[model samples]
Target: MSTITTIGFDADDTLWQNEQFFRQTEKHFATLLAEHAGGHDIEARLLEAERRNLAHYGFGIKGFTLSMIETALELSGGKVPPNVIREILDVGREMLSHPVETLPHVRETLEELAGAYRLVLITKGDLFDQERKLAQSGLGELFDAVEIVSDKTAATYQRIFTCHGDGPGRSMMVGNSLKSDVVPAIQAGGWGVYVPHDLTWVLEHADEPTAAPRFRRLEHLGELSALIERLGREG
Candidate 1:
């Protein structure tokens, strides 16, 4: 196997605290509409709304905000007050303005690997929002390049790996989501290292790779440097 020369990282949930904010916002939203629907019912409807709106609004806080509003309107039988709508918007604004909290060992791991490989950030979300987060994240300087894409797929990984590194086998993708980060990169012939997060968005959930040689799982980002070193040596 070709030696892994390029490293791609997923931003949200992987490098920083992301899903927790969404969960908190969801909790706040549920409380706002508790009269219209129970917590479970409201959460289910909001998730469905988010899924349906993905193609239309794409991904990001803006889309999530709209989905929450839509879910509120639907559950309230179009009777949701303007003040409630304003509160929902406020939730989104707060999320956008929230500080980017780096995950444990994220900065240190990136720093350790930065000089040895071409580090790339492969994240899917709103461009402006991603950019803002990157700016706020002190770890931005570690990434050689940043790609804020609309989505993650095998084709996308193939193109990115091919451009930045020798090819798929020579590149590795590290992330928290199996759906968006690991599976697609592995399918594209790149090695994928899964670093599980405490919380994951339901939409980004996917089954684990059963028996892939190039797929490895770790408990956290702190263990990533060792995994990469082992992979490099084994190759």
Candidate 2:
């Protein structure tokens, strides 16, 4: 039998439609600053602001909105009108209120695996916003436990897997971001399955670990069940 006892999943773009909304909002943001800056320049400055503010604001819609406002103020020489800021806030609110659309094969795949292994929803972001998304997803009950963390690191996976299952050695993490989900989970001595999403955020990008024995990649979640079965048989 396979030694793996727990299966962890990343939320955001992994399980549902997330980054697309952010992308859409970014386009709108650029439009709002059309007179002040070009789209490429605005995008670059916004990314810079986001990177700088991550330590203070953390993640999710609130942080993103703050970064957008900061970029607008800076790009517009501190003359960005109040109405623009108000529109930014409105877009942020729209993101928070947007319906959770689970990705293809997510539900059925989770259903297939849930009966055979412990499932944990491990994701990082604004606590309230993450909670809202999870509740809206209708996939909450599928998870044996839910961890909405400030970040994902090797230590984070080690602690979570140990607390929720046998240990990291016997756990697997599936997600879209190699930076936050795959690399750290593998470094924690667990299997890291990469499921690439077309709309993954730029900051979440990382080089793939193709030679790692515990690393795996899938074209989509629909392939996960067969991969797990193959692993089980390999043992």
Off by over 4 Å in 1: none
The predictions' CA RMSDs to the true structure, in order, are 0.8, 1.0
Enumerate residue pairs that collide in model 2: none
- Residue-level lDDT of model 2, residues 143-192, one tens digit each, is 99999999999999999999999999999999999999999999999999
Residue range 94-158, candidate 1, lDDT tens digits: 99899998889988899999979999999999998899888999888998888889999999999
How many residue pairs clash in each candidate at the backbone level? 0, 0
lDDT of each: 0.92, 0.94
Estimate TM-scores for all models: 0.98, 0.98
